[model samples]
Target: MSLELKDVEKKVGIDTHIHSTNLKLEKNTINILLGSTLAGKTTLMQIMAGLDKPTTGEIWFNGENVTGKEVQKRNCSMVYQQFINYPNFTVFENIASPLKITGVKSDEIKERVGKVAELLKLSAMLNKKPDELSGGQQQRTALARALVKDSDLILLDEPLANLDFKLREELREELPKLFEDRDCIVVYATTEPQDALMIGGNTATLLEGKVIQYGKTLDVYNKPENLTSARVFSDPPMNIAEINKNGETFKINNNNVQWKSNLKIKDGKYKIGIRPHNITTYKEGNNSVEINGKVLISELSGSESLIHFTNGKLNWVSLSNGIQSKNIGEETKLYMNIDEFLYFDQNNRLVNHG
Candidate 1:
């Protein structure tokens, strides 16, 4: 019970929407496809579901080639960003529709539908039509439909993206448990970083039609393979600046910051990467790289704050705990841990993993 895509590529006229992709999705675990819109997450999922034909390569399910198979022949289910349910049918009927088509016993359909609806918190709306339910309820009904059917593969294409923050959070928390015991392959496609983090699964980070990185979610985030992978996995976008090695000192160009490095490299240009959270308010007794800057913008998101500032010409950002009190044009002191830095070469390849 596995899904494999080998050298799968999708082309729209002259434009290649998905590059040659090779992936092996294991069973009983959620595999997340994380990327921005137009990054080819949906395109890849569609190919896997038999909804779209690959321009090249093959799709294998459980070691059997399933390329060019019709959607009906595949034991798969899909949920999209928009809520999709049979508007004319009651929630219970919608959930049982798939089973009914397969000539499942009415008694079994009722049991499965009831159990899934309860898990998705749609038990109370069993008798209501989709039009009569709220947005969240309608989506839940669709999810229940998918869950009721014993599909070996489930594709969730940003199913929670259209919901409110509160509802999305609630569902995000429940989804892991919802599929825990199901011995199937679940692939969830999402653009939000926190959504992938909350789901706690293996992640395939896509960028511009290619899978930039694929591994355990935290492993990929903490150690992205390259600049493209790092950029796609980043939430606020990692701060990057050109740097040059000058004799014994490495200078961050465009900013008056210099540090001594022991790494043996040619005295040439490079790029330095640092995440926003790594930058913080300056503190004494810490072996921190200090910098002076003027605040440009300050935003409070719940208990945390994000501060954007500039050290003369080079702009930087810092994400700090608690609400940051600062005004635009105010002078501020910032610090970065000496060890919390990534150095990249001119080709955007990570050179140092400090």
Candidate 2:
């Protein structure tokens, strides 16, 4: 079944939590609600789940208006960031709770619970209590409960966020596969840009209670509508700085470095956006513009390194592959690929390279 919201807005006293927005979630597809905290992801989900009512606007499911309906009337299952389970109940009992509440036969409940447990690798600990399980196992139990319900709408609110890095990575890879054959709408909320990319889906990027951009994940990531959208979709944030454009020349850092491009535009001031990964230390001749900067911070993560560099008053970052041993206060050569630059107008709207 499909779910849709029309002109939905949420307000608390004088504060607006979710601005007027409209969205239609397609069936059998993963829809990613991508944004940082207080971006209205949870509020929106709550509205749809009937936990909170929208101050205005309507909600529709499969062409029927369900705005005033209760969550129990909609047949939806939700898994929250924290493990929501009965502390005194065994994992098997917790997974079987929903089915029992709906008065499903014991035989069918057993069959469904067993299949979901095996899928989540929770079969071995079905008899254990919540406190006896590890963090991952506890989360798997929550997921199993949700899956066993066989609800048409599934809302997962950062279910893997509480786990350790290695475990989160493992679950992120496993989640999409878990719902492969389900004919339902899955809405997954996350605060990380990498998480949205990791789970390939249509993404709705929210900012300050507004839906700034919504489209296929890669399209929105590669071509953000404006600076806010770009910042919301980018990790490490996109390096931004004011630049002067004159004829075919674009100058940065008071013209200490000049990049000449064939794109024609009005001579004025604008902001330039360059991704950290697009900036490298290797020199590739005229295709790249080289500049000198002092390293302010360098962080090594696995086989990659993130370097924060500053040139005078200007600060930027470079994400380099392999191990980097650059130290603080060290001078380094940074090359930015001119071809990869995204030019935005003074209003921070992506206008044109020409």
Candidate 3:
């Protein structure tokens, strides 16, 4: 079933927090709500799952208004970051608890629970308690419980945040598959950009309780609505620099930088943004605006290396793949990716190119 949020606004007190926002989730697709900590990711999910009421606005499911519906009344299952499983109950019992509460037959509950456990690789741990399983296993049991309920909507709140790197990778690959062919709309909230990209669906980016940007994953990543939205998704973040448009040329601190396109200068101050991967390091170039800097720190992570260069007053990170520099104190020349630069006005709004 499809889920839709219409002008939903939630406020804690006198402050007009979480303004009226709208979002829609297509049926049977994984819609990832990507944001950082305290970004209202969980708050929005809670409102959608009927755990909390919106101070203003409405929620509709399958074209029907279900705004005031209770948590259990809505066909939804929420899996939190912490695996909330009964300590005394075995894995099978935990998975079957929801079914039992709904008055499903014993035989059907056993069959459904067993099937979900096997799918999640929890079949062997059916007899084990929550304490007996590993962190990943416990998460899988929680996931199994959610799945066995046959809920129309599934809400995942940073479910993989506590797991080890290896386990996180494993479940990241398998979790999406769990909803395949099923008529359930999965709304997953995560801080990891890699997870959102891997899940690959409609993404809504929230910041400070506001829905800043929402669209296809790639489009939102490529063209963010504003500076804050741009910095939100980019790892190593987008490099923001100050620039001035003087007549036909763009100037940066008395130096004339080549303009990729003719820009209209309505404002005195302008912000330029570029991704780290888009930047290229050069040993020598007369035409390029040269910045002399010493390597402050160098970090190598297998295929890619992150080098921090400090040029007295300025410091920037350059991302390079399959390259290592041992010159920590030695000065090196840095080149800016002029072609890939994004221009923004003083208000932190992106300047339209076309």
Q: What digit string (tens of lDDT, one per residue) describes model 3 on residues 178-286?
A: 8987888999999877788888877888788888888888777777778887887777766667877766666654434445345565646788777776654653223
Q: How well does candidate 1 score on lDDT at residue 43?
A: 94
Task: Kindly indicate the candidate among 2 and 3 with the higher lDDT.
Answer: 2
Off by over 4 Å in 2: 253-255, 283-286, 352-354
User: Would you list the C-alpha lDDT of every candidate in the order shown?
Assistant: 0.88, 0.89, 0.82
Model 3 off-target regions past 4 Å?
15-17, 246-251, 254-269, 280-292, 352-354
Of candidates 2 and 1, the better by TM-score: 2
Per-residue lDDT of 1-354 in model 2, one digit per residue for the tens? 789999999999999999999998889989899899989999999998888899999999999998999888878899999988999999999999999999999999889999999999999999999999999999999999888987888999989889999999999999999989998888999999999999988899999899998888988888888889889988888898889888998998464877888766788898888888888777644689987889999998788889999986688888878877798999999888887788899889986632
Model 2: lDDT to the true structure: 0.89
Residue 331 local lDDT, model 1: 97
Best by TM-score: 2
Could you estimate the TM-score for every candidate? 0.94, 0.95, 0.89
